[model samples]
Target: MAPTLLSSPLQGFTDFRFRNAFQHYFGGIDTFYAPYIRLNGQLKIKQSYQNDLQLENNSTLNVIPQVMTNDPDEFLFVVKYVQSLGYKELNWNLGCPYPMVTKSGMGSGLICNPTRINEVLHKAHNESDIVVSMKMRMGYENATEILDAFPILDKYPLKNIAIHARIGKQLYNGPVDLDAFEKCISGTKHKLYYNGDITSLESFKKIQNRFPTIDHFMIGRGLIADPFLPNMIKNDTKAYPKNRWEIFSEFHDRIYQQYDEYLSGPTPIKMKMLGFWEFFSQSFPNPQKIVKAIKKASSPKKYQETVASILKNV
Candidate 1:
């Protein structure tokens, strides 16, 4: 069977604008998981979150809205809200490792508490018609933390479980634990998807070889680092698109223009582009220099000039 490819959600980066631009410029992702719609204690979904998941805003692509919360009420609220938007599936975010999210006993931090996981799952499944899936890490503090929660998860009919094979404490810095991931396969019967350091075709091949039965994958930083990665992986081709630079330039420009129009200040736009460049710079030659040039731009004009210079050189 052909493998399923998913675009992983990165909180600050994978907004609707980026998703739309990426779909226009590239191919190979079967589904795009939107960044989590965070529900605070107020139980209110932010307008931005509502706007992001609006059917009209996402008409071009297949999208699944992800929700981050440890509360059953919040999860159910998201269920009803997204279903009202005509979505049939919702992804629960149990994978975020950021300190602010984890410290609150949400995200990966909640994995250690099997009781809480059970409560949330029971309530959600019993009360809603939404099909639930989960994106998660192995554990919050230790790699084995998921062990206790696996049995609880098995009690429900999850759409699927995508595991990023690192403990939350590592926070995307350390090597992904393939052994731990293997253990996860043995521990649960649910459909599984892998999400970790799949940065290159070779790495992807290695992972495929190791886990031959698993077919779904979620690419996060890897896709951001190389927008062409999904196409390359899907086609098993190393050749670049004939007008790769032209297409990439258009993609970047669309994102830039959208941000510029929406954002009020020069600094906000410059900073946002700079953030994207952190991953985008890796695709070009002399990435360090490219990133440095992007970083040095204090004003929007300087940023555009720096980008144009890089594009000209490329």
Candidate 2:
């Protein structure tokens, strides 16, 4: 069976603009998980978050909105908001490993506390009509954290649980613990989706061979590192378009233009593009040099010139 490919949400990177452009240029992802919509203490959703989920903005793509909150009231508020916008499934972001989010007792920090997880899931499942799914790590500090929460999660009828195979404190550093993830699969009753370190066809195949029954995968940084990875995985070949550079240039240009139009100043746009280049530069040869050039670009014009030169040479 063909596996399902999901575009994992990365804050500040996989916004509506990037999603639309990616879907337009490359079409392999089965569904796109939007970045978590954060509610400030004021209970108001940011305009940028609202814009990201507007139906019109995502008409051509299947999008699942994710919410990052430990508070039940906040979860319900997001449920009603997304339901009003016509989304049928909502993903609870218990996977974010950032200290800022975890320190607030949200994201991976909440995974170790079954009481809080139970409270949120119970309220969300009973009060909302939409299906609630969870994207999470094994724990904040240790792998056993998820074991404690599994029973509470079993009590709720979640659509699915996507595990990233690492503790939150690791913060995208150390290797993903496939052994621990295998244990998680045996322990949980909900459908599972694997998310982590799938940077190449070889790695993806190894995981597929190991877990033949698992069909869903949520790719984060790897997707940015190699945009064609999903296509390669689905096609089961390393073949790429002859005009790969041309297509990639066009895709990058579109994202640049979109961010240019939305952002206020040249510095913001330059910084934003540079951030993307941090991952995107990996797709090309001499990535360090290319990233250095992009970073040295002080103005929008300079950045464009550097990108154009790199694209031409690559």
Q: Which stretches of candidate 1 lie over 4 Å from their true place?
A: none
Give lDDT tens digits, candidate 2, residues 1-314. 77899999999999999999999998789999999998988678899999999999999999999999999999999999999999999999998888999999999999988999999888988887889999999999999899889999999889999999999999989899999999999898999999999988889998888988689998889898889889889998888889888888899999999999999999899989989999998888788998899989888888888988998888
Per-residue lDDT tens digits for candidate 1, residues 1-314, read: 66789999998899888999899899789999999999768878899888788998899999999999999898899899999999999999999898999999899999998898888889999998889999999999898998789999999999999999999999879799999999999999998999999988999999999999899999999998899999899998788898988888999999999889978899889889988999999898888998899989888889889998898899
Per-structure clash totals for the candidates: 0, 0
- Provide the global lDDT of candidate 2 against the true structure: 0.92
lDDT of 1 at 83: 95
Candidate 2 ranges beyond 4 A from true positions: none
Candidates' C-alpha lDDT? 0.91, 0.92
How good is model 2 by TM-score? Answer: 0.98
Q: In model 1, what is the error at residue 13, expressed in angstroms?
A: 0.6
